[model samples]
Target: MRNPETILEVDDLRVYYATPQGDVKACDGVSFDLRSGEILGLVGESGSGKSTATGGVLRTIGSPGRIVSGTVTLDGEDILKYDDEKMRQTRWQKLSLIPQGAMNSLNPTMTISDQIADVIETHEGRQPADALRERIMTLFRRVGLPERIYSMYPHELSGGMKQRACIAMSIALDPLVIVADEATSALDVVVQRVVAQTMLKIKRELNVSFIMIGHDMGLMAQVVDRLAVMYSGQLLEIAAVRDMFARPAHPYSEILIESVPTLTERKPMKINEGITHDPRNPPSGCIFRLRCPHAMPVCSESRPDMVEVHPEQLVACHLWKKDENGSYVRQSV
Candidate 1:
């Protein structure tokens, strides 16, 4: 299939956190493209820079956290260069974020309509009460929230309903790209499924691209068109979701797949026993070398460049040898 138009591009993006000890490279040399209307999943263990990368996209890097380098292009414009005033305009209308713990993001005392109206009015200026209510009602229906709940307080709704409200606010201005930072993680299995379906519907109906940030590979596989695996603040692999499942080019990606419970097949998975990744002081060369079973001497000596192992699949590892054209070729089994 042909690739869709690129809506967002991240090049060598590096975000660091300042602490007493030293700078923690939360997102180091991360790069990827988010195509139009595509749901791209960023999956990794906790503290693997998944959240930080999403922050970089939204330009929401908080105190002590700095985006030291890299360019984040949104709709053909480098958002990193956008002034605060410009960024304020870009947010919600051009790019929006559905923060993690979305249920908690909603104000406790405010009515759902009031919260959503705040976003619309702040960006698009004050509209007639009738027009504003109509717009909010449209968003409510789009996200599957009942019309009656529009004036209800956040506490009046269930966890799932509150999350839907949050989603409604995120899409209040009809953004081109939505960064869902673990949007469905806090809900129960049934509720998670419902929210996922709602998100898919929005994508289909609105033709909006998404950056789905989560650690649940199985859940991500259900909705994401592509997946990017990150570890120790570095991208280990990126590929079509099906391709990553069939043949994970990076050892780290393969191990992650092995850890997933399969419905049809059951086999002993190779566990990386006692291996831990410390972001503050990662390994010498490849960040995953310490845990990788197939680590070679070169893996500890030099960092590996990202190379294409197959069409639309890229892996960064020393196990793969380079060809005459400097393309990555799999080693003999």
Candidate 2:
């Protein structure tokens, strides 16, 4: 079968934050692609540049933070080059964001229906009141939200309802790609599952792509088609969720997968022992070498380029080298 067409591509995207002492590399040469109708999970620890990378794509980085270099191509166009007016026009029409905190993202004063209607009116101009209400009702139903909450304020809904409401608003315009940055992070476990199911249902009905950023490995396993691991502002590995879980290519990926708790067996978490470098001053060669258990002399010499270690599995690590046949073979330290 043919591969799905690429919908969004981020190439060597670099985002930085200015500070009194130096520039912090919030997203240093991170790269990944979102396939049409596929959900890509961006997983990492806090401050791993997952959100910064998404912010750069949405042109939401402000003040001290800026896109230092690279390109974000959406539907064959480099959106990073769009003028302010064009970008604004493209936001809900072609791309949308379901921000981290639903409580903070919504307006406390405006009713949920009005808030959603405001988005529709802003992008598509004024509509008849009845038609608008019906449209909002359809969205609510699609996301499994009750229509009763449409007239209620933000403070009135439960955490799951608010999140589902946000999801409804995000799909109001039928955007080509939606960046859901920890959309369920603040919810209880039961609520998180419900919200996740709502997102999956939306994806199936709308055939839209997504970039779901979070630290939940279990959630990532259930929802994402492909997984991209991030660390120290760099993409360490990208692979199919099953392949990565079965045979993680990068050491960091292995450690991350191993850290997830299991019910059948008990094992010590492998990720809490390492110390990451300061963002402003990363070490030369491989950024993960400092914390990697398999560090070698070559790891500190020069950075390893992303190499396809197996079919459709890419990893940035010196331990895997191309042999005479051009197949990646493990090397002894």
Candidate 3:
């Protein structure tokens, strides 16, 4: 059984990619706490390294990927040192993954029933198909898909149905923590809403914590309790969802929230240019200083430490500092 108190905690996570050119620091010093029933949002641009950090949690980091340093504690126990024997047991049972691009993960040739059956079979401890089939049917119902989908092949399912099936597969084990890594990105708005609804339903019904990794702030705000902002390979801000959207502390987060298209104008907010593409070579001092609207000489010359703004908010910016007279000071660029 999983602990109801702390579901997952990532401390000082560092994931690097050893490439021919140089070591690319995809995730450096990433840390966060995931409580039971809490949804944590990982928001950032395309190459912000959010995916790599979560991927490392489940030991799913692809070739040349390295976890270099950090401790991933699931239910107060370190999971980084888990043996393959233990990892095989913990992967789906304790923590599950609903990967991005569901279309690519499903095998077109196999029927949905067989595909799901294969996962249960590979995991061990799960019962035979006869006993599991009924559960599979119920999973389909939970995800709002018809039970008849069990017999259909991957090629027979629509995009949304396939996505739902992937979710069903991930949740079959009833993991304590579910990492939905951009699970809704490929769908249309209607389907995205449906998926989000299903996710909420799953969370409520299963009492599982979530680490929702995606770039959609509005969508994330609707699902997660807190949002963690990442830039290059660093976490710039961590705050309550409402606080993040209402008043972001980090310049990078502010820029990201601003980029979200306001319904009034319908055009997305434009952020100032410049993001280092090559992860191996992030800029000196503050990684976001080059694009930060509030960048100061101090910001470009030294890295700002993570400063606690409130009981529940943490930010990495020199601007949140106060003057000796106890007045808040907003530094100039």
What C-alpha root-mean-square deviation, in Å, does candidate 2 show against the real structure? 1.6
Ranking by lDDT: 2, 1, 3
Worst lDDT 10-window in candidate 2: 267-276
> If scored against the real structure, what TM-score would every candidate get?
0.95, 0.97, 0.93
Model 2 error, position 296 (Å) = 0.5
Query: Clashes in model 2: which pairs?
Result: none
- With candidate 2 superimposed using the best TM-score fit, by how many Å does residue 313's alpha carbon deviate from the native? 0.9
* Stretches of candidate 1 exceeding 4 Å from the true structure: 1-4, 264-270, 273-275, 324-327
130: Cα error in model 3, Å: 3.4
- Deviation in angstroms for 66 in model 2? 0.9
- Could you tell me the lDDT of residue 281 within candidate 2? 87
Residue 323's lDDT in candidate 3: 74
Which portions of model 3 miss their true places by more than 4 Å? 1-4, 126-129, 266-271, 322-333
Which lDDT tens digits does candidate 2 get at residues 1-333? 124598998999999999998999989998888899989999988888999999999999998999999999999899999999999999988999999999899999899999999999999999999999999999999999988987999999998999999999999999999999999999999999999999999999999999999998999999999999999889999999999999999999999988999888877655465436877889999989998889999899999999889998999999998899989997766
Per-residue alpha-carbon lDDT of candidate 3 for residues 162-250, written as tens digits (9 for 90 to 100): 99998898888778998999989999989999998999998889888889999998798788888999888889999989998888878
Winner on lDDT (1 vs 2): 2
Clashes of 3: 0
Write one digit per residue (lDDT tens) for candidate 1, span 114-218: 989999999988899999999999999999999999789988899898888888888889899999999999999899999999999999999999999998988
- For model 3, what is the C-alpha lDDT against the true structure? 0.84
The top-ranked prediction according to lDDT is 2
